[model samples]
Target: MYKSLRTFSFLFGYLPVAAMNLKKFQAQKANLSKQEYDALIHTEPQKWAKGIMARTKSRVETSGLDYLPDGPALLVANHEGNFDIPVLLSEIPKPFGFISKKEVKKLPVIPVYMEDMNCVFLDRTDRKSAYKSIADTVGKLKDGHSILIFPEGTRSKGEGVTDFKSGFIRIAKDAGVPIVPIAIHGTSEIMEKNSNQIRPGHVTIRVLEPFSAEEIEKLDAKELIEKVKTTIETEVQSMAQRKADLQ
Candidate 1:
């Protein structure tokens, strides 16, 4: 309880630092190459995320990070909680962005921030807009950027992963990029399971094998998504078992 409150206060404490860094990134966005831009922009946020987790006396343990490809690839992960974003920023070796709802576009600085960070926005209610979103994502990927998507479309909040939406298949197929499956566990315990409170918890991030673009090109949509889902599910179950064993 006190930990959560103090953590929130620490977050607020960092707002000025975040603002200063965002301003710097915004200014540098045009001059840097994609790789340089990703590496530069993600540094501060990653540090901030780790700081927040540390303040709560929480930790993250990750494995199979070598599974991440050096080239562009679509990162697919199970949505467990809000902390998933912070966890990824803190743990993943490389920088990546995710699709956001257009509703966030209305916010003041966010849209620009997201744009500088290589994120895209779409209106879920509009079919045409969704298609455009996919096309835009494909274009970015082809331009040499990696993207992370939560195919479940909603957080399971540690209740076990739900069914994945099929849109990811189209993104990978059209972009000609590989699909990297990431299985994450225990983030929900830090917030969602604690009644929105922060608590000390260990989160696990397992970066499973990637399905190469050649594999993406060969498999049908249904088969591909099924295979990806099964891979993530199997890893998540194994992560759960490990946590239980240490109890």
Candidate 2:
């Protein structure tokens, strides 16, 4: 009961302040390029996220970043917790964007920040709008902004990952950007699906090697998708298993 109340209060109290921040964000977004916007977001995100992580008592250990491409690449990961998105934004060093659900655009301040980061929003229920989102996302990628996409589209609690959605592959192909497979584990332990409580926990994010766009083009799209999906799942499961073993 206390946890639920805490979550509700947080939402209600933060909304109005967040709205004001959104207006400030909109006034600034027009003057920035995708990279510039990313820089702007990160300027204070680290300090802010550090404080939040401290409050939530969340710990994140990242591996394989050394293997990631230094250039623009599509970043794909499994969404697990409500906190995972912010965790990624606060942790990942690259100037990246996210392909988010349209509902997120309705948020008070977050959508403005997302837009500043060159994030694209898709309405899954509207097929046409979704396609337009894909097109716009590809354009952003082409303009030199790497994007983070949750191929599973929604949080899947702490269970195993769901099937990869193919729409992201089309955007990657269209943009001719490399794909970076990221496997995140233990996020749901911090904030589970359908719940807002921030439980104390640790998470792992593993950055896999870049799979080149040119490499994907030679093979059938279906085959390429399968390969990437298998690789990411395998990595995520391995990390999860390792974490369990340690515990």
Candidate 3:
């Protein structure tokens, strides 16, 4: 009963904070141009995420950021917790965009805000729509925008990454951008797979080296997917082992 109350209190507390942030975002939206709006949206979220991570008593470890070069690249990471996206978006020092589900477009005000911030949403159930979305994402990359993709399509419920889907590789190839594999750990434990109550925990993000577009161009889609999956698995395992050792 106490735990349930705590959860309820947390949700109530977070909702208002989210609303205020959104309100502020809406008020400021018209003052910035398209580029400025994208920049602020990306940077402000990182600040908000860092504050959230700090409040939740989480810590992040990163590596291989130097591997990201100037201009555009595809960032692929393992999704474990719902919090992972905000965590990554908070710290990654690049003007980046995200590939999100089309269903989010139905979200009141948020989708309009996302559109203003230049997020690309894909409709999974419609083949033609998905291709059109992919083409739109590739165009954004061509316009020199980096992007984050969880090739696993959804969050993993436990240790180790699920088999990667090939769609991201297709996106990277079509966009002519390099793929950077990022491995994240501990976020699931912070909020768990199905729960919403945020717990104080540490989350580590391991940014592996970027694989150049030129490098993967010769490899088939199947081989490229395996390579990124292996890299993320290795780093995520290392983080898990490190957490276990500390315990």
Q: Write the per-residue lDDT of candidate 3 for residues 1-247, one digit (tens) a residue.
A: 3443554455345545555676777688789765565676665556656666666666777766777677788889998978877788767887677888888877545565466556799888889987887788888888777788888888785557998988888889998999988988878877774366667667787778888999878899998999999999998898888889998
Clash pairs, candidate 2, are none
Better of 1 and 3 by lDDT: 1
| Residue pairs in clash, model 3 | 46-90
Better of 1 and 2 by lDDT: 1
Candidate 1 segments exceeding 4 Å error: 105-110
Clashes of each: 0, 0, 1
lDDT of 2 by residue, 1-247 (tens): 4544554465445556655655665578789875676666665444445545555667888888886786678898887777777677667777677877778867666676677677898888998998898899899888887888988888878788898889888988889988898888887887684365667678888888878888967768898888888888898889888888988
How far residue 45's Cα lies from its native spot in candidate 2, in Å, is 4.0
What shift in Å separates residue 155 of candidate 1 from its native position after superposition?
Answer: 0.6
The estimated TM-scores of all candidates read 0.92, 0.85, 0.83
Clashes of 1: 0
Inter-residue clash pairs, candidate 1 = none
Instruction: Please give the distance, in angstroms, between residue 59's alpha carbon in candidate 3 and its true position after superposition.
Output: 2.2
Ranking by TM-score: 1, 2, 3
Off by over 4 Å in 3: 1-37
Error of 2 at 123 (Å): 1.1
